[model samples]
Target: MGLSLSRMMAVLTKEFTQLVRDRLTYAMIIGIPIVQLLLFGYAINTDPKHLPTAVLVQDQGQFSRSILGSLQNSEYFRIVHVARSPAEMDKLIERGAVQFAITIPGDFTRRVVRRDKPQILVEADASDPAATGSAVAALSSLPIEGLKHDLKGPLASAAPGPQPFEVVIQRRYNPENITSYNIVPGLVATILTMTLVMMTSLAMTRETERGTMETLLSTPLRPIEVMVGKLTPFVVVGIIQAALIISMARILFGVPMAGGWAALILGLFLFIVGSLALGFLVSTVARNQLQAMQMSFFYFLPSILLSGFLFPFRGMPEWAQWLGTILPVTHMLRVVRGAMLKGVGLAEAAPSLGALALFVVIVAGLAVKQYRTTLD
Candidate 1:
């Protein structure tokens, strides 16, 4: 029981030899961080370009024509559809086909001629607040000179142009158009998906790689209990991370939590469960921790890129937007951002919550089934 320096030295020397013999540790220390840096650099673009748009020209007058022409001329809008009616335009916007829609009323030109306010309705999907800023700015500024020209045409004798009706501008979601207000909501989901999935999967992979999983299975401990225990810590960690991010957003980034805190937390719980379950599936199939990490990153890439986290959901190519629907992170992000920035209730967040619930049920069932069969 007395101090034994020789024995301690021998144990230290043996551990060092084992560590040096295993090349995997050194590769891990050098390789993984490098790959993360490269991926982040390429994929994390904030200033999205070439956003698609749809035009709803209910009015065929000169004022409507000029406004539509401005949008068409801009590099931001691709103008995929020139909708004949409001109903046609609404369908495209809801299903995610278009990033913007300019609705020209029947009185657009007449109002300007009659010296009344000329109205142009621009419905911008402010889901990705950062990218939508440029579009909103351009659209708001569109009717300015055109309306002035129309107003001046009627008043030839007057020295200056009459004041055309004030364009009552309404920017959806963030009326102030704050980027952090929108970005922070989505950040919670992105951070949770990466951390929750990677953390749980790494531990599961660690058990199998280190050969402790076999010993646990041989004992009386049930698979469900082991899994529940494994997940409990991560659930706590995920929630804590969510709180930290939300607080940082408020203090550092000026993001407001406009929605009910309870709703955000509940939705986040479902999101975390779904994400961790997906990681469990990855862990079940992967042969080692490295492979698990690689597989997790594959999932992460599509989720972040196509989930409307890094890119505007409305702005992506049609095929990419369709692919985004397959991931639960995309739906949950809508719920979180909707609640936080839009001040939406459970009614508005219901669809996203339902999607997360379905994804969780499916992934959790598959993971548990695969784990059981693998043990047998």
Candidate 2:
């Protein structure tokens, strides 16, 4: 008649025994967050290197030789292949094999000395804007510098010789090159997605594995109420994670918020909801937490690659960029970072906000529906 406090201790002990057997789950719950953060932070750099360039040397003259010499010596371009004509250059770039192709006009030698300047045509694949930039900077500097040296011609001028045309370049978007401006905002999205999804998926799956889900089903609580209650703690975690991330950006990276805080928070909330709902949907379908984690990772890879985090959005092919536009992370990244760093208004982030909101409602509703009714 009285299985009192002493007897209840036996049941709690049995629960502890079951938890201890699943050490892999316990380790993953504790370890993956710290490990992935360190790895992604240090190892994942979008900046590309060793750009492939094809060279076509038309003239064997000293000036042409010097230009070619400079190109060979520079770290930016690796001359993996060569072309003899403009047609060849076109073929090389068109094949999607080369990042840049430099052509020396057949009359380069004669033109340089005779006209006091010869121009070389430098064609680059703008497909990868970031990689192309470094290559262009190196190649462009060589010709002008070579001409200046030749123009001086052992004569020291009292006045600085004809100041060649200069470009007062003004950089846009990310002017300062501070890692934070680009990295911090993207980290907000990435971290929120990773943490909220994994956390929600694991917790729900745990309830099912323990056979407590049937007990919950017996209660009067509706499916929607149960999902909402399960989601509440993770939402709090998402907000706390956001605050810590922003603080890290401010104190460690010196990133400033130039835009309104309300817009940033609103966009972030939608994005988090979408990602978390995706996890909840996965939990409903997966038989175990491992499958749920694997599913999240499956989505994670493409999100990182196509989300414009490690690559320029404009650099991707039209089809690829169109595919990238569908990811909620992509829209959220643009909204939060562009607004916070660039001081962009909601009018500017309107499209991104709209996309994120749509994703949120669709994912959340689907998750609720799937959790309520079995997919079978």
TM-score against truth, every candidate: 0.70, 0.60
Off by over 4 Å in 1: 1-109, 121-127, 144-168, 220-222
The Cα local distance difference test for each model comes to 0.73, 0.69
lDDT of 1 by residue, 95-158 (tens): 4456677677777666666556666677766656676777666655555554444444334333
Candidate 1 local lDDT, residue 1: 96
Error of 1 at 342 (Å): 1.0
Report how far off residue 178 is in candidate 1 (Å): 3.1
1-376: candidate 2 lDDT, tens digit per residue = 9669978998999888876776655555556676466435543444545667788887777767666666666766668887877777766664445766777777876655455344576676552345456656655567456445544553224213443212122233444445556777788888887888877887778878888887888788876788778787777788889889988887888777776576688887888778778888888876687867866775676677667777755455556668779988888777767666656666666778899999988888888899778522
Q: How many residue pairs clash (N, CA or C atoms closer than 3 angstroms) in each of the candidate models, in the order given? A: 1, 0
